[model samples]
Target: MNAAETPRRGHCSDFEAPVYRNRWRSLALALTGSLLALVPAAPTAGEIYRCARQDGGAPLYTDTRCDAQAQPVPSRTPPTIAANPAPDLAARHDQRLQREHERRQALDARWLAEHHRAAALDQRIRQAVVEGRVVAGMSAAQVRQAWGAPDQVIPQVGDGAPRERWVYRGDRDGTGTRSVQLEGNRVVGSGRRAPEAPSTPPRTTPPR
Candidate 1:
């Protein structure tokens, strides 16, 4: 073989072929790895705030409320995931709705408790006032226990028999009024009347 051809064949060895191929492959892999590192990471959840009561003080997010003077801080821990992925969306929504339902139930229970207490106090106060007014020929004290106190009372005086008028009002968001009229100390007549709502006063123009 010619001298140049002989040298070329020696240089083109099996070891040389693999070394060149591996060098290019290594460079390609390193470039890909560098690009992946440059990519940004996913975002996370944010903060929340809470307070003891509105107008009580500035709000904050803590298991416990701060002092009246101290403003609330951003003290609550953020949720683990900012949004629900497809697989978890339904479960997350159900959890949120359950929490809402529980919150509503708690609020309703508190409202009902307060309403019951107020109603009991009002009944007691009315009974004291009515008991002092009972007289002969009038409905006995038993009536008072059965029915609430009179909203309107008309005193009576005359021969034959004296008379009294007792009016009972109902609660219907001011839409209706119910009255039970007691005459001569006994329940005589009862009726319901549509409430005459007060007309709204005309608004006056502000002085120029």
Candidate 2:
């Protein structure tokens, strides 16, 4: 070789040495990354925090404490309930209805008894009328029982007995007058009279 070629070859050798060094550095970095991937990561210690929303919204959970509207999470459990409860609503309702039914039954029985008593009293009055037992010595109530009410009752004085005459005047055309006399509450007598004659004098004697 030439004396000048020696220097040029030395410079080429220097450039090629830097390229090999760069390749060796890249290979070392790749091997270090693979080794790191194989090694297990350590577990991090974290605190649980609960964050509140602006309105009624989904709750947020985070490992770090929140600065706005946040609180540490608390443990929660379900509430305990009794196995055997008190009487239910349906049972109480049924009892109330039963009591009302009994009350109505009692009222119905009392009304029926009163109705029977009135009917029996009416029957006794009819029997007295049929037997013609409404007479002197019978009470005024007994007279009323047989004849119901009279059309007129007139009081009399200046007589043998303080008396009241009850008159039943038939409808017009002068049919007649049926009268019952009572001294106090006792019936003294009862009779019917012919219609008055315009020319005849009134009778002073009580009817027999």
Q: Return the top candidate by TM-score.
A: 2
* Residue 193 displacement in candidate 1 (angstroms): 3.2
Task: Give all candidates' CA lDDT scores.
Answer: 0.62, 0.76
Cα displacement (Å) at residue 197, model 1: 2.0
| lDDT accuracy of residue 17 in candidate 1 | 88
Which window of 10 residues has the lowest lDDT sum in candidate 2? 39-48
lDDT of 1 by residue, 1-208 (tens): 8875554545666668899999999999999999998865332244233555677876456543344344334455657866654587889899999999999999999999999987886676466446643222235354466455657766766665565656556534545655555555565555567877799999999999
> Top lDDT: which candidate number?
2
Q: Candidate 1: TM-score?
A: 0.25
Give candidate 1 regions above 4 Å deviation. 1-142, 172-177, 202-208
lDDT of 2 by residue, 63-145 (tens): 65566445557646679887887778898899999999999999999999989987886676567767744666667777777
TM of each candidate vs. truth: 0.25, 0.32
